[model samples]
Target chain A: MQDLLLYISLIAAITYLGFKAYTIFFKKEKSCGNGSCGCD
Target chain B: MKKLKVALIGNPNVGKTTLFNRLCGVNQKTGNYPGVTVDKKQGNFTHLSHSIDVIDLPGFDSIYPKSLDEELVVDFLKENSGNSDVDKLLFIADGTNIKKNLYLLSQIKDLGYDIVLAINMMDVAKRKGILIDKEAIAEEFGVHVVKISARKGQGVDELKSAILLESPEMKTDKLIYLKPENHGVLMNYVKECVSENPYKAFLNITQENRIPEINVKKWKTEEAILRYQYVRKIIDKTIKIDKSLASDATTRIDRILLHKVFGYVIFMFVLLVIFQSVFSLSAYPMDLIDQFFSWLSGTLSSTLPPGSFSDLITQGLIPGIGGVIIFVPQIVILFLFFALLDESGYMNRIIFLMDRLMQKVGMSGKSVIPLISSFACAVPAIMATRTIENKRERLITIMVAPLLTCSARLPVYTILIGLLVPDQFYYGISLQALVLLAMYLLGIFTSAIAALVFKYIIKNKYKSFFITEMPSYLVPSFKNVMLTIWENTKSFVWSAGKIIVAASIILYVLATNGGEKFDKAETHIMTEFAQLPDSKKDAMVSTYQLENSYLGNLGKTIEPAIIPLGYDWKIGIALISSIAAREVFVGTMAIIYNIDSDEEMKITQRLDSEINANTGERTFNFATCISLLLFYAFSLQCMSTIAVTYKETKSFKWTSVQFLYMTILAYVVSLIAYQMLS
Candidate 1:
């Protein structure tokens, strides 16, 4: 059960990071130039 | 519901954003200075059984745009003129300064726009013993007028009612006319090609250079003179001012705040107070957060059965996220002070004071705002360069903006500084705070030098000029300051949290597993330390395994290049991870050191206790900490900032040059600092 949970969490973390990198690099956010990058 | 699309038009520093916030019941930023709204913002609200979409355009003084921000408004007007894309223009004007505002209003009227004049800041005008005849102005301009105080929320409902109730047929007649005989053929060509409205057609022809005989420069000048003449006449008839009751408070304060020498002294004093407060005020809350995370890590480690999964939770996720979560108090205090300075109208005077110095570096006072805003983040600061008119100046501003110390760098600095610098205070200001201030000043100094270099390289035909409005000082609204702090803190945590957690998991996996050497670490340690106790043997084995782990091999690969900078494999690993985001450096450190099931020492304490195997000395010595701080100060380590620079400049050459330049600067400077100190 512990090994099973570890694999599940590892997969989830990988997927989450993959999705985030995609959005940051590939996804063209609709910027009307309102500083929506949350960096503001 | 019926829909109405209206655009809010105004001159700068006239409370347009304040009114927009009131109308939408959402907090868009409002400052007592010009160029606050550099981008068009859209918000919607349901009122009087109609859904109204309001477009808040960046402010400008006249139809002819002086900056990219003002050009946005001109572009919006040109696109919507006589096309019915926009149903109404909600023209906001400062009641206390109606004369100068009327100049722009007169120009807009000539374009035949359907407008309702909302005279804002009536309370301020009343206090100054200035009275406006709303009916007379309305009668003269042939548009509806509403008195309002957007800050006080006094006339927002009435303004909304007027928006839905005003007739659509109330378009203003032309205030400036072109003779048909003098330019009949040009007018016909413009109307057929660009716009049917005569003034708009003339404007398009002149702006596009379609007709050389039109004498665009002469016409624009004459047009301005005529509009001002008409505006002066209108103001004389419809306004009254009593000189005796007018207040001189702003003038009196400006005498001291804008003084030649004392101005800069006061500004430096203000920065000192802000940085001091960031350290003093955030100490208790930061302590609580640190203790809480430590408790959580200890509890999870003891409660869960010892396994890989338990290790991941206790070592990877908890420590990683805790690294950034602990700095929330400092981030909040920094933004809170920034918001207060902006709302109090002191920031504009700083711009005025800095204009001379900025011009010496080949930038106008306008670049100061973007550079200052860069202290928060480079992405938005680069976007804020739209307010600058000169192309070369704007490009330079974008290039150097990332050099400023943003909130992301705060965590890295804090952890490193806390590890080495004593927490002692002198004259009621902590030593750590003074170091932080020096780091920020170092950023500003370096950026100015870089700007001077770029100014000599990039060439432009257009001249740079600085124009800003000094707004009346007012007490900052507590609600607005708190909202800014909350929004920024929430955004920082959410955005950095995702990256830190993911990086932690990947790093955890890397540090824990390896090839044959890591697998045999326990056996080798047991044989070498046969006489040691069981606990010491286990620690030796963990250390041996970590040194042979996959993460260790990767760090060793770059160890040769970084060794001159006094960095080992672990510091090299953290440096590599920081390229993802600056704050990730702290998270990487936490994950790298906290992998074993030991007592929950704070990350700072862990780092302080770190020792170099080769030298048998502290890993993070005075030389390494100073070198690391200097490196982060100059390095373009953020992918987001790199992406934003590309987006803003749209040139790979510039972006590549910026990245290489900053990296080289960081390397050379850090190398020198480490060598000299060591």
Candidate 2:
């Protein structure tokens, strides 16, 4: 159970980090201060 | 349920967003200052068995567009006018300045859309002894009028009920007619166009330039004069002010607060108080949070089985998130002060105060909004530059915006200050708070100098003008201030937390697991120090294992480059990781220290107690902390900022120039600070 949980947690963390990086850098879709890009 | 689409339109800072918040229960950014809403925000609410969708639009002075965001509103209105796409228009007007606000309302009223003219800020107007004959105004304009105080929640229910009523299209009997004979193509185009309203057709044609032969500049100036003249006549008949009962309180306060010399003195004093309060007020909560996380980590370590998963939880995630969570008190306090200043209408005064200084630096007073907005984050601040009309000024504002210390850098500064600066007060001012203030001031000073440099580099002949309206001084709404704090705090944690947690997990894996040298570290340490006691041997082995770990090797690779700035391999690791975001530096340090240390301590404690094995000196000394702070202040560490800068400039050349200059400045400043202080 411990081993399985560790693997799952690791994968989840990696996946989230990967997705966040891709969105911020590649997709260029990050929001702050009203959560909208305010772009036309 | 019936579906209704109502677009909320008004002049800026006239409580359009406040009314929208009241209707939709959505906490969009509202301020006493203008141009807060730069884009149309949508929210839906169910009322009277009707589903109403509200579009909160950017406030503009005229029906015609001036800036990009205003262009969006004009386009939206043009598309939806007299069409089923938009069911009605909700025109919110400032009751105190109805004469000025009604100009835009009159234009929209002439557009032939069913309008519910909500006279907002009725509370403020009443206090000023101004009374509006709503019935007379309604009769004159041929639209429904509702008196509302969006701040006080007065008559909001009545306004909602009014919104549901299907009023007949009311065009003012007095129309400012354009010359059809002189502009034959415009009249012909308006007739053929789907828009039945010739005013809307004219505004659209001028902007779109379908028929370029029309003298648009002359026509626009004529239209404005005619509209304001009409608005003046309506106001004269419908509103009354009692001179005896009117208050000069706002003017009285502005006299002192806007004084030439005393104004700046008071502003500096206010900043000092804010910084001092941030440290003093949040100290107890920050300490409590720190202790709680330490206890939780210790408890989890003993309770769980001695395994990688337990280690990950206790060492990786807890410390990672705790590092960020510990600084929440400070972040909350900083934003609370900002929200209060914004809500109470003082932020506008600061803009007005700084306008002179900004002009001297070759920037308009309008540049202050984006520069100040950069305090929260540079991403939206860069986006907010859309409000600035001049190309050169806007570009300069964008280039220097990221130099302002954002909320992301707060955690890094807090921890570093906690490690290096004493908590004692000198003459009722906190030393730690003083250092923090210096960091912020450094950002402001650096950005101003950078703007001056860019003013010359990015040349433009077109001059920009600064015109800001001072909102009447009123007590900031308690509910709004609290909501602003709640919303910002939530955004900070969730946004920074996600990055911190992920970085912590990856760091833990790299720090704890390695192949050849990490596996043999214990044996090598024991053999090298055979005569040492078993306890000492264990400590040596732990140190050896960490140094040979994958993360350790990676840090060592870049350690030489950062060594001159008084940084070790671990600090180098943090520098590399924090490029994703600034707040991640604390989390990275937390994870790195928690993994190597035998006993659990707060990040500040670990950092303070950190020693160089070679020199036996403190790692985070005054010099190092100051260096780190300066680096963070000047460097463009945020990926979102870089991305948004690119999106805004749409030029790789400018973005690259901004990035290179900022990074080089950060390096040179850090190098000087570290070298001199040591």
The digit string of per-residue lDDT tens for model 1 on B427-530 reads 88789988988899899899999999999999988675565877878999899889988988997999888888888888888899999999999899888899
Among all candidates shown, the one with the greatest TM-score: 1
Q: List DockQ, one per candidate, in order.
A: 0.40, 0.50
Worst 10 residues of 2 chain A by lDDT: A28-37
Candidate 1: share of reference interface contacts reproduced: 0.57
Candidate 2: stretches off by over 4 Å: A1-4, A28-38, B1-61, B65-204, B207-247
Compare the candidates by lDDT and give the number of the best one. 1
Per-residue lDDT for A1-40 in model 1, tens only?
A: 8778877877887898778767766676575565434322
Model 1 TM-score, 2 decimals: 0.73
lDDT minimum window of 10 residues, candidate 2 chain B: B27-36
